[model samples]
Target: MKPRLAPYLFVTPAMTLLLAFGVLPILVALLVSLTDMNLGGLADYSRVSFVGADNYRELFGDAAFWQALGNTGVFAVLGVPAVIVVSLVIALLLDRGDSRLFRALRAFYFVPAITGIVAVSLVWGYLYNTQFGLFNHLLSLVGVAPVQWLGDPVLVKFSVALVAVWRGTGLNVIIFLAALQGIPREYREAAAIDGASELRTTVSIVVPLLRFAIFFVAITTIIAWLQFFDEPFVLTKGGPLGASTSISLFLYQKGFSASQFGYASAGTVVLFAIIAVVTLVQLRARRIDAED
Candidate 1:
């Protein structure tokens, strides 16, 4: 083979695997979405009629779907920024300190990130228990009434978002810490000499320098929040009148529970489009900032 052909040959296996596993499934799902396919229809070829965009239309008109989308949007809007800020602050503290205790603390903070979501959610579920939770116990000590953390519809989404932030912040902290450490010492010293206080230097110098990392963390967190599932699924099961039902959970219910494969495929496609658009927007914004 020629040199160019050799490179293609080397990548052929991986490309073939991707096509077989990824591309083929997506194409099949798209086709299925255009049809009135169901589990029964799979066995009977004549029953699987092409329904065009009827599945898409039904998904768009679904009140449950709209509610789920709104809930997901709210979760992402609140959770993503909260996680980024908390993580950045933790990262800054960890990056600045030299004590062995601080190093140990970093590991402690990161423990949650590595823990399985199911296990963590189970632990949090106990902590959010209406009568016996640690949270209620703490509130009792302060003469405050116990609040329903996950039971009430209004508070359910916020509670899930809080758990998501707690679970997610650790990884972003590590990422931000690594980014912070990569900054040269001279920049801080120079800023100090110019009468810049720690806060001012952090906001003006450090943050600007860490923009790329911040942008990266923000985009990832947004994507993660958009697919918010495990916490709500385990803790509340999208409960309290489906107020915490995320788009992912909705898709799961449609695809698995209700067996509406065609509608589920349409929802999945919409989700992919939304994520793609949002990610592209973030990338463009980052590019603009870089140019400025």
Candidate 2:
């Protein structure tokens, strides 16, 4: 085969799979978003109707949808910084030594990320148990009242965000650690020789060098948080009165539980648009930085 044809031939299978699984599903969803597809329509073709922008219009006035969007925004706002700062600090500490113990510590931190979120949520549920949780017990010892972890609307967001941060920290830490290792030792040594404190050297040299990696993590993380469902679904079931219902969970409830597939599809499309725009902006920012 010619070189050009060879490249196409090599990519043919993957491209076909992508079209079949990824692109096709998105196109189908877009179509669904334009229709009044629901359980009744699913059961009888006669009930199906082309609703055009009706679903999208309804979404604009949906209180639950707005609440879900706000909850997702709150989650991203709290989670992104917590995950980045904790992971970067741990990565910095781990970068200090290459001993076996330190290696084990790194592996230990990564364990949560590899474990199933359902399992993690279940374990955390037990930890958040009001009557007999470890956290409550600790508070009892200090004469402090047992705080509601997942029960109250006011506090549930923070509780859920804590789990999100803990779950996300491992992966971010590993990425930051890899980026830390890629920086040359000489830069840090030179800073030290110039009487720069560890904190100053880290803030100026290490963080600046890791900017690209940080950007990657931030963008991907924001996307994930936007679609966050599993933790809240498994932990709070989007309650104490829908306090933890993320956009994904809201979509699932509308599409599956309430039989409003078209409405859900419109929400999904809007979410996809947001992710695409944010990702493109990040890519453009990275390109500009590269040019500089």
Compare the candidates by lDDT and give the number of the best one. 2
Top of the candidates by TM-score: 2
**In candidate 1, what are the lDDT values of residues 85-196, reduced to their tens digit?**
9999999988878799889989989999999988998888888998999999999999999989998998888888998899998889999989998999899999999999
Tens-place lDDT digits, model 2, residues 1-292: 6887998999999999999998898898899999999999888878889999999999989999999999999998988888888988999999999999999999999998999987998799989999999999999999999888899997899999999888899999999999998999999999999999999999999999999889988888888888898889899989988889999999999999999999999999998988899889989988999899
How many Å off is the CA of 28 in candidate 2?
1.0
Global lDDT of each model? Answer: 0.90, 0.92
> What's model 1's TM-score?
0.93
